[model samples]
Target: MARSVRWVTGAKTQWTIHGEQLVDENRHIRLSTADVELPDGTRFTQYVARMPRCAMTLVFNDQQQVLLMYRHRFIIDQWVWELPGGYVDGVEDIAAAAAREVEEETGWRPRSMEHLATFQPAIGSVDQPQQVYLARGADRTDTAPDVNEAEKLDWFTLPEAATMIERGEIVGAATVVAVYRALTLAP
Candidate 1:
């Protein structure tokens, strides 16, 4: 029988965490193991990961096309299309980080960034909070994009982006969410 904890009160279906111990931690992520008890008295240990918040932008042009980066994610070992983004630096404003990532990764400076949504990419095991922004316009900067960030930058219509997502070409959660949001705003 699972002993009821004082912290959980209302919902009988709610899983309660009895204890958690840190496994490893670094600048990117903190990993931990948690002892959890289910509603039916089942108990198990589960791995949990927490990561720094990330900000990404969906930059658009007058043509209603979105700016995207063609990059290789070494972890996935595949080249895919993604929105410009990165982990928010310590104490940095998330919108500012979104704009900065746009300029750094694509050499395009966003005219303005408006918060679209904040979401968790993998709610099951990873606690990575991501912020998505909508930029209706941008200007090409004199500086070149960081070579390490992306191999190329291009613009695609929202419908095209949706197709790409369906085809497994656009895989990043933030990018997919931004595209759907932009599609909702499209004429």
Candidate 2:
């Protein structure tokens, strides 16, 4: 047997999609435009971006330090702190994909993994869902990250990580959410 939970919000608004077009298609992403009617009877065509769901790993070591990557993102033109994560490969399980990304990016594998949360990283424009995992007892391995990946790896205590986020050092939404959850959520 299963239990169902109903959620409610004070306000109600509905949107109806008349039609949608796949304006652009590629191996990694698909861009589309949808003609939609709002609850207020206003209608318009809006562009949307669709991408494969990805996973993020918040690997914490025995010392309670979380693993992170420091890299320069050209789009942002700044070096930012991020977690080990990437897009899910073809037909791969979300947890498995997170483990793979962690190993490939940080040369470490988690001895135990737990699903933390999932969300649409860019809910307003992109339909890219992200699943986050809390990885414990991570051990270093011989595997190396891709050459195009992070410039360096480091671990930070929970407080340090939280401070980094507060100071805007952690710019990525996925990383921010995972780190915040890691700090606040119970085991």
Once superposed on the true structure, which residue ranges of model 1 sit more than 4 Å away at CA? Answer: 1-12
> TM-scores of the models, in the given order?
0.91, 0.90
Q: Give the TM-score of candidate 1.
A: 0.91
The clash tally of candidate 2 reads 0
Instruction: Check candidate 1 and list the clashing pairs.
Output: none
Estimate candidate 2's RMSD in Å.
6.5
Candidate 2 TM-score to native = 0.90
RMSD of 1: 5.2
**Candidate 1: residue 62 lDDT (0-100):** 84
Clashes, model 1: 0
- Expressed as tens digits, the lDDT of each residue in 15-67 for candidate 1 is 99999999999999999999999988999999999999999999989898999
Candidate 2 colliding pairs: none
Q: Please, what are the lDDT tens digits per residue for candidate 2 over residues 63-177?
A: 8889999999999899999998999998999899999999988889998889999999778779999999999879888888766789999999888988998888899998999
